[model samples]
Structures are given as C-alpha cells and as structure tokens.
Target: MADAEMVRRETSFWRHAVVTVPAILLLGLASGWVSNSGYGNPWFDGLAKPQAMPPGWTFGAVWTTLYILLGVALAFILQAPNSGTRRTALILFGSQMMLNFLWSPVFFGMHQPRLALAIIVVMLVLSIATTFWVARIRKAAAWLMVPYMVWLSFASILNYEIIRLNPAS
Candidate 1:
C-alpha cells in the first residue's frame, strides 16, 4: 500500500476525531451564522416559493448536516500528505465554500434570486470539480462530498424554480 494510504489507515480514531470534530464544529458555526443572518426575514417570506419548496425548518437541518460532512471531508484532505493534488483540491474546496456562504446573502438578504441562481450554478460546477480533485487524492474524502454535490444540484433546481415562480424578482 502507498505511504499515504498506510498513514490514513493507521490513524487512531481518537486522534483523528479530535481534529475533525473541532474543524467540523467551526464549519457548522460559520454556516449557521450565515444562514441565520440571511434567513427568515419579511422579504423572503413575501416571495413566491416553488411548489416543491421545503419547509423553512428543513433548510437549517439540511445545511447543518452538510456542513458537518464538509468538515470531515476537509479533514481528510488536510491530513493527507502535501502534494499538488492536495493544493488544487483545497483551492476548489475553498472556492465552493465561499460561494456557498455567499448564496444566502445574495438570495435572501439582497432579494435577488436570479443572481443567486447564477452563483449556485457556478458553485455546483466548482463543487463537482472539487469532488473530482478530492477523489484523486482520497476516495473516502470524495465520498464525503457526495451529499454536498447532491444538495447543490437540488439547490440549483430550487433556485431555477424560484426564478420561474417569481419573474418580477
């Protein structure tokens, strides 16, 4: 087996958990802040929602779960041996995260679902690219990102539907 794979396999659960858990916690906190800041205002409440739109509470639950998964995936990348692939993966990861954070502000705070849709589309692409890069370095890390990718796709459809539902916005 490769040295990196061996290192990963040999890692103690407690040691790894100590690192990944805190990192995940921080991610969850930041994402929660972003969500709280831009969600549940009168403006958003006034907007026409798509037929398939989930309940308001669902967003919070789903995002929290996804952020935790993202933290674990990032831990894998960070723990991996430094290499060009790792660097590239990190960049993609960072880019997608920023876009993810920005979407709420653009859509809910700014009240521009159209622009938000555009942002999410880009986010989806970046997320996919990140997944591919992460897969190259660590398949398990890549698997961690699957839910995120799926969520982004679902989010894109929701955004598109929002646009169609509210043409004036």
Candidate 2:
C-alpha cells in the first residue's frame, strides 16, 4: 500500500512536469525569437560584448537546459500541498517568469541595456526568493534552481559589462 501511494505521488509529479517543461521551453524560445535577442539582431551585434561572452550558440543551449530545470522545479512545487510557503514560492516564481519573459524585449527589442539590467537584477532576487521558499515546500525544487541562479549571475555580469564597455550606447 505504501509503495502504491508513493508511485501515485511520483506519477503526479511527472504529470505536472510533462505539462510545465514544454510550456516553459516554448515560452522561453518564443521570447528570444520574438525579440531577436541573439546574434542576428543589429543592435546586439553592434554592442560592445564582454571578453568573457560565450559563443552565440551557448546562449540557446544554456537557456534550454535552464528552462527545463526551472519547469521541473515548478512541477515539484506544484505537487506540494497548499501552504503559506507554497503560495510565496508560487508568487515569486511567477514574478521571475514575468521578468524572464520581459528581459529579451527590454534589451534586444527596445535597446535598453540599463533598464534590462535592472529587470534582470530584480528577476534574480525573485528567483533566489523562489528557491528558498521552494526549499521549504520541496527541497529538490530548490536544487533545481541553482543552475538558473548561476546563469543569472553570469548574465548579470555580461549585462554590466555591456553597459560599461559601451558608455555611449
């Protein structure tokens, strides 16, 4: 009986993951594509890139993996019972998602690196909050966000460098 209950719970988590992973991946891909965030954007291509900037393809690869991890994290959170911590995690997660979706447009579409930097910083804070709140609800979910936080740290540095390098831009 215990094994059966465990399998059922595990199935529920998997079911949520199946829905969330693809949804987040599609949204992330769409956001980047719609805003022309990467190599082909004229403004982006002309910007003063940091010396440590990875290859163009690396962005897609890293983001794809990060989004999948985030989606799985969301699924883990979703499978948990309702509580104050869970609600806080959900709110923070949603805030992060909104900021994430807005970032490419703010930077690549509107050509506002400074504003985008602000957004990214707030997003990072919210993501950190989400991870902690998720830790209270689901420990594994918190681990899933580590890669995302690390990537955000790198991206923040890159954004700062772009602004520093192109003071006139």
Candidate 2: minimum summed lDDT over ten consecutive residues — where?
Answer: 79-88
User: Model 2, 1-169: lDDT tens per residue?
Assistant: 9999899889999999999999999999999989999899999999889999999999999999999999999999999888888888999999999999999999999999999999999999999989989999888899999999999999999999999999977
Give me the overall lDDT of model 1.
0.81
Quick one: best lDDT, which candidate? 2
Q: Supply the TM-score for candidate 2.
A: 0.97
Model 1 poorest ten-residue lDDT run: 31-40
Models 1 onward score TM values of 0.84, 0.97
User: Model 1 — TM-score against the truth?
Assistant: 0.84
On the 0 to 100 scale, the lDDT of residue 44 in model 1 is 70
C-alpha positional error of residue 70 in candidate 1 after TM-score superposition, expressed in Å: 0.6
| lDDT for predicted candidate 2 compared with the true structure | 0.94
